[model samples]
Target chain A: MDEAAVSSLAARLADAGITRLGRSLAVRHVDAGSCGGCEISLAGAVALRAGLTRYGITLVDDPREADVLLITGVVTTTMADAVTRTLGAMAPPRFVVAVGDCAVDGGVFKGAPTVLGGAERIVPVDLLIAGCPPSPGRIIAGLVALLEANAAPVAAARRSSRIEPHA
Target chain B: MNPALDVAIASAAPPGTAVMLDAATWRSLAAGDARLGFVGLFVSGGRVHALFTDGSAPLLLATELIANAYPSIATGFPQAAWFERLAFDQTGATAEGATDRRPAIAQGAAGTDAAWPRFIETAGEGFYQIGAGPVAGRIASPVHRRFSMGRFSMGRFSMGCFSTDDTRILRLEHRLGYAHRGIAGLMRGKSPRVAARFAARIAGDATVAHAVAFARAAEAASGAVAPPRAVALRAIMVAVERMTADLAALAAAVAAAGDARFATLLGQAREQSAVALGEAFGHRLMMDIVVPGGLALDLRGDAVASLLAALDRASLVVRAFAWGRVRRDLGPAAGIAQARARSIRALAASVRADLAVVPEGIIAAALPAGTGTALGAAESARGMVYHWIDLLDGQIRDCVAIDPSARLLPALEAGVVGLDPQAAAVLIACYGLSVGAIDG
Candidate 1:
């Protein structure tokens, strides 16, 4: 709803890109507390425009095998632990991409008692795609821009200085 | 209505509202009426309202509660178990003799696992427990399931995990409601037009069904009938949405059956249908397509043409695949029984049948002003969806949406027991349960 705030988040996310890493990236998708709307877009974006596999993005079943975690929905009180555990399970050089308006800032359900706001409240987010449910093309563009941001140095530093997973 | 219920309903009901029956009569009808199917159970105004459909006619029955406690009728209608707990969570009401009393949707304090309830451990030897998801892989909705298993078979299955070490098979507890957005609560005091948006978002995949249901409820409450053209267009939209959802459900089933080739074909069909929906409607999910007394957007001829063409392509794929030939072959391992597969096949066939029947044009009537209470039901992909609305002074007083998933999810949990995790996931997908829909 706040266009200025969303644009700033997008601008911030554009600062991180995987320039030095290999082309292929293993991704683990976690639904923290989605209504399943964002998932339709995620699947559609990957299938129609991006051809995720063609872009060297492979979805894996295990979090341990993933380089990037694409999290959808707002982090509910019930699902906050799963989000924390999932982010923690990912190895170094890992990144978190928050998809949909809910994950960005809790969307229309912002003040709901059950929700813990957005993905940022639970974990550090690298990118935020803002839409009630973002269109497939917009999702692909956001992801591509994220790849081009190239925050490799920061990722490397964060890996060496890692303490607790949530921090 | 049954003879006894007709008398009670006629005597106790006020004007257009639901009938208020005494506790004795309510329990008797709930247990004795063999043809009565439970529609929904909710708490409103210090009373537990039970909705049911007797054959083609829908009936709403209510029983007053004292001190927030009423006698449990779950023994008569097994489905009332969850509704009772939901009633408790929302209004501090309880079914006096109900079996399960855990909190259904009440969120605990932040940072604590207080929201999750523990499973009752059974008595047996060498039984181990496995917990899967409030968050898991691939599934879009979060569901937590705790399974007690032996070396070779599943011992007991529950939804939320707690520390328990019992050896026998206990009840399987399922933890849902993580996606509750307070749609019903949010709709209160809003105009029908404003409330329709919230209803449409109840379950994104079933947006059309929910929108239509809500519109129907609003129209009924206001004593306004939508134009025939609007109704036809609404029917067309519902059919298209159902076709797309069925294809996706089939894709999940086929993939579970290890037929990657067939799954890809179905997936492509679903994708094309979605694209066509976006072309025709403003939104891919077709959100907010229906309004209080009519349809929102008038359909363009080209939009209808593209949607029909897409449906035809999907029908051709379904025929070429010979869906009925493989219907009998599906089993629990594939997450669908032969019966369910047969029904899904029939759904695909219905989509084919719908291709020839298209709405002539898109037209809608203006909303009328009135105040009353009424119920509406629409056939969703899963099953029937019912919506009841009470309007006073042109504003919503109370509303309840009865999603088909609410009735089927418990059965799904019970049926998937003693199976491997992969099989369980497949079964869960086949049910096409929407957590958001149920919570609403």
Candidate 2:
């Protein structure tokens, strides 16, 4: 919660060859609102015997079990609550990666009345995957970068001030 | 022009003609006509128009309601359910006496206040509800699924959240509209050419089909026809798009069944088609390629040769996969499994049929300025996509792009129920319905 904790978090993230959580990183993807293109590329990357699993990354269904939250599409107002709930459900040392142009900043649908812009509008994003729908290769690279950046450390240090436990 | 007639004489304009009708007569015809396919319902020019076709007919019928309030055709037709919901969402036109009147696409405070479908507590013993995502797994479109479960088995299902009484059997509920981008409003006031881009974006997977349908609608409204060469080229695009979509669907089905090798091959084939199309056209998705009256780009020189080469290569690879084996692998585990296989065969046959047409001539033609309502249709990977456009003084007054999702969703729900959870998941993957495509 203090400046020292923030600095330590940044230092831990910047270091290479260090596993932050000391375990396999489990990711859960939440599609706020997308045209379904990004998921195609994501599927390609994470299919059986593909890149994600080779790196010890697991695609999970529940948010509570995940270490990283991969959020896609523009965060529609209807999905705002779901997004918040998913983000909140993640255990400490969790990361949120905004995938696609829509998730980062709403892309082509930014100003639509139904859209609330991007994933950042609802929750803090640790990394942003850029593209109308980022190619599988690019998505894999972004995930690697976020993993190397130690999302867990920042997540762990910010737990006290960043998220309030539900009463 | 006969108010009482079910069939209207279509105008010779490129777009199909409209039939004006009193509200009472229109509702009756729409409900009573068993042969008619409910294309879409929309509000334009202070009247609600329902698009319908018997499939055997050459013309698409537009039955206009004289009053804002009309009886719900879905009550009788069943297929008109989502179309009516869309009409209400788009124009605030009410479908009187409709069974389900929940807003289809509108979300947040501007429309429905509750983002989640309000679950009604069924007074049944030992049944609990499980909810699935607005943000589901890897797929991009946001849709919610709620299932009433009895221990290990699944009960009734709902999509987009409506209450049901039966709590003992497996029923599915789908909550779509989380992917709403206001595409209808985005098309408003734009030129036919400009609006075509929005149509293309309606579903990235079905970009070419949407674009062609929009282009045809524009051409029809403007009294112009795409040249033979353009039509041939457009057919090629449609065939290639269908191949890619089928490959993707097959890949997803194969993957769900845990066949990594075939899944990867199908995925590669899907990507190959996209790459081939991108090399031929400008965009990978081929968005904005088909413009009003003609195509935005012509296939020429090396582009055509290389594209042809890719198509041939893809065709050989597709055939080598042995689609029959894929269907056999699916067995009866997945309900839509056979349907998906049948789709691939039908698509392949169509593609082969299209390839016989040599494309060489004037790619585009000049479209004349005109004013009229017209209907256009293109066979997409899923089903027939229809576009109805009303033009006034060369400007689009009202337009509707009807994707196949609305008609297919109920069938998907029915297919999903009673299947084991694993099988249901596979079927869902195979169907590949985009919520945005349905609700946009």
**Residue-level error in angstroms, candidate 1, position B31:** 2.8
Candidate 2: list runs displaced more than 4 Å: A1-25, A47-51, A55-58, A148-167, B1-15, B57-67, B108-121, B150-169, B300-336, B342-370
Write the residue-wise lDDT of candidate 1 on B1-440 in tens digits.
45667687556433325788877777675464687787778887778888877676677888898888888878888888888888887778888878777778776665565765667674465666777776665544577767766434232454234344423323356777677667788788888888887788777778889889889889888878888778876786787777777777776776666666776676677777777778887777777778888888776657767776677767766666654534533456333433344444465556456545645653666667668877777777787788888888779988888888888877877876656555566676677777878776
For model 2 chain B, the run of ten residues with the poorest summed lDDT: B160-169
Name the candidate that leads on TM-score: 1
- Tell me the tens digit of each residue's lDDT in model 2 across A56-130: 777887788888889887887777888888889899778888888889998778788878998998898767778
| Candidate 2 residue-wise lDDT, B1-440, digit = tens | 34355334334233356666556566675445656566666677677666666675434444454467777777667767777777877787787888877667666465456743455553455567766677565543478777655433332444334344323326677777777777777776667877887788778778788889888888877879888878887887887777677677777877777777877776765665555666677656676778887888876545655555555555555566665666666655344545554565566566566656656777778777668777788877788888878878777777778888878888877776655556666777788776778867
lDDT of 2: 0.70
